[model samples]
Target: MDWDDLRIFLAVARAESLSGAGRGLKLDAATVGRRIARLEETLGAKLFVKSPQGYALSEAGDRLLPHAERAEQAFAGAEEELSGIAGQLSGQLRIGAPDGCANYLLPQVCARISDANPGLEIQVVALPRVFNLSKREADMAIAVSRPTAGRLTVQKLTDYHLSLAAHRDYLSKSPSIGTKADLRAHRMIGYIPDMIFDKELDYFAETEAEVVGLASNSASVQMHMIQAGAGIGIVHDFAIPFAPGVVRVLADEVRLERSFWLIRHADDRRSERLTRFAEALGQGLRDEVVRLEREAAQSGLAPP
Candidate 1:
């Protein structure tokens, strides 16, 4: 019944532990536990079932989830309407993105957004996996592939290219790689096969390399490995500007194209602040990708 109690409930439900919820809510674990107990008593139903894994939603909790989420969104919309102006954004906005975009793309894009709206605080959570929008893990997420399921809205951000790349020094010292077949003789750098979270990220599927000699789930790490002359790997064209030592290998022979999708909670459509921010974010990414890719091509590190 109380909005504050519902807020706590939502936090606990997302975190799945009292201490975790407390950390987010800036409350002590004991106080959070007491609040949850009081809320449960007021509702006259059990909201969670405790286990070693942490608190999980009960049937009553599941039924309450949607209503609580709607309340949260409504409150957020009201706050944004009152606190924000028509053209400028304020308050915190968090984005979840893959490490590649986070490392090579978002820094400049987000910086421009922040510069235009000095009151806004942006947090970029770089992870290798898909973000859970239902749990409010991030306000929005930039995904390598379009997700097939969830209460979400997906927009195509941009199509980017990847090509086989390696350190210029490594190529001079290693066996000549005239064709994809020659890759068999050299060590490869890429994602761990089993840890490839999205089918779109299977950049090595078309390659003849039998195994990844050096692997990482993070694209930035894989790029660093290539820069360190570890071995050849597929690198984003937009990222080429950041790793000056890395150069394209088999640029004409091997090129991979992938897209980034902007995903947001479907209900966020009602929030004017988020809608404006999303527009700015989309444009910034498009421009940044183009600028970076052009720089890479100009440097003779990627295809023009």
Candidate 2:
């Protein structure tokens, strides 16, 4: 019945383990367990069933979820309202994104946003897999493809381009790559085929390239391999500016277009703080992508 108890319950449900929930809540696992026990006693219902895998929500817990989420949203709204400075973003905002965008784009973009709103604390969770916004893994997520399901709001953040690239030294020493077939003659660096988390990241899907001699699930790692003259690979145009030694190879023949989408919980539309932050974040991303791509083009590492 208490909001604080419901808050703890929500965290436990999301994390599915006392230790995990404790870490997020900054409380000890024993303390969290005691709180859950207390909450269950108050409700006279068993909210979770413990197993080796972790806590699985009981029927009562599942039933309590929607109400708890609504309460969480209400608390967040109240905090935003009490903060009083509607224009200034304050508090934690976590963004989950693919390693490519997080590595190439977010640092500077987030820095600028933080500079403007000194009280804002931003965390970027960069991983190769899709983020679960419903579980609160991130306050928001930037995805390569639009999601078709869930209580979510999606916005196209920006359209970005990618091209086959290699270090200048590698290109100079390697045979001419006048066509896609020529790619077979060279060592290729790319995402591990089985590890590619998204279809859009399968840059070589349509190509006849034999195999990835060097592979990583992380885009930044692949870019480093290319920069080290390991082999040619698909690199984001917005990322080229960061690797001065890298140059586009077969750019005209191997260009790819992909867009980043800003995804958020549908309920967030009711919060002005998140709405303003989303707008600012989207605009910053668009601008940074343009600037970085232009710089890459001027450096002759990407198409103008």
Candidate 3:
């Protein structure tokens, strides 16, 4: 089958609706349907099973997916290579990361990317989780989740240590809190139930956290609430400790741990600009991790 047809197939498989794929490609739904139908007719097999809800890939379609994905990666690499020969890094490099990493961790490295590459513009998509690299949703991502696929690359970007904290003024009014059990008496500002944290905090159930307050999706907001002395709270050293008036109420032996992995489509690993960008970004991460740790330690926070 033609490469363009494979692309159409991939989009339909992903979107799960001929109409949805048409919207993405700016083609008419009838045209999309005809193309997919033509493709399946040529191949002599059903690629999709349609229901009232949407399209789902048939077994034949599933078998074709990985090869189609790899072909797309090759095409992306070919395009990037030709562009790279023009001698400067210029064009959008779509990078995805969680909002937490974008806010607290990636700034320095992002700045460095801008400084080093000059013309290389980055579309920093703040997704809650890793983008599907194999699907070309993002060229690269700084992911909190460990690399599950054996073909990917992973790194330990850094660790952030949290502290039991409140406003110093609040502590002055209230007595100093000692031991984990004292947490039950204090109001704790907690994140919304759906927050995509770097790590799980189910251990908090074992702690004395009263968790009497709730805030929306942002950790930054939760931090402000805690600093307002609304309640005692746990804030990440990376995400929130830079703010004023928030003081460590107690040092902790337990800490949440997470690491960022920079994953790319393995098929494109040999491409020049993609290689350079990944390497530069990885170096930036290494330097940033050290810088963050120094700041956290100076602030008297423990390390995870």
Candidate 4:
């Protein structure tokens, strides 16, 4: 069987649609469909059942999935080994992270890594839910909480701060809040209760109010709502400087701390390229934390 055909099969199977797979492989839909047909003929087995819903894998396709994945791994390993001998890192590295951190932090780090290794490609997946490293969803991940058990290596990324905040206008017009008890009467913005991806993200425990007046699954959205004077909300301290008019509230009275944990599959621990990229990611975060501290001090927003 042609390895190229297997590659086409894997792409189509993962995408579940001819056009989708074609887009991923940079092939026209007709070509992708032809290749799948040829691959099925070569194997003398039906690999997919076509339907209006798109292709569903037949028994043969299901059986071939793991083997195809292994083939992909072997191909990648061979390429990495060749690249190592040439003193360069080449190929894709996907890093999964929470949406807020990805937006605020990852771009610069990814740029630095890519600049240092021109041949390397970086893919960032910013999601609210955790990345499944065990299933190879990401090459590495930055997580709010560390994994308790898995074939994984974990390390401290950084400890960042959060505090209650609101737009200047919101505070001006809203009820005064002198203490935790006073917060009860004001409108509050926060994460959607049931959609909170992790227990660590349930930041309301620090506040006297148990419910939010406005809620979102995205930190960015919550920040926007606060900036628009929808309500007071807890926000990352580092992000406050970027969103003008949003000011920290009760910083001295309420300081919330969270740490990012860097995680990688045990199998990737030995990869020099992965190690270098991970180190770069950590250094970038550390620099950002330092910058946040300086900005907070200069702006008079530092916590007591």
lDDT of each: 0.91, 0.91, 0.70, 0.83
Decide which is better by lDDT, 1 or 4.
Answer: 1
Residue 191's lDDT in candidate 4:
92
TM-score of each: 0.96, 0.96, 0.80, 0.79
Q: Write one digit per residue (lDDT tens) for candidate 4, span 1-304.
A: 8678878888888788899889889999999999999988888999999999999899999999768866766666677777763565678889999987888778877787778778888999999988877556688999999889887899999999888888888888878777877789888899999999899999988999856989999988898898898888998887777787878888778889999999997767666677877888899888887787557545554121
Ranking by TM-score: 2, 1, 3, 4
lDDT tens per residue, model 2, 39-118: 99999999999999999999999999999998999999999888746468899999999999999899999999999998
TM-score between candidate 2 and the true structure: 0.96
Write the residue-wise lDDT of candidate 3 on 84-171 in tens digits.
6346676778888876667776777878788866778887888655577755677777776676775565655555455566766666
| Model 2 misplacement above 4 A | 301-304
Q: Lowest lDDT 10-mer window, candidate 4?
A: 295-304
Q: After superposition, how far is residue 147 of candidate 4 from its true place, in Å?
A: 5.5
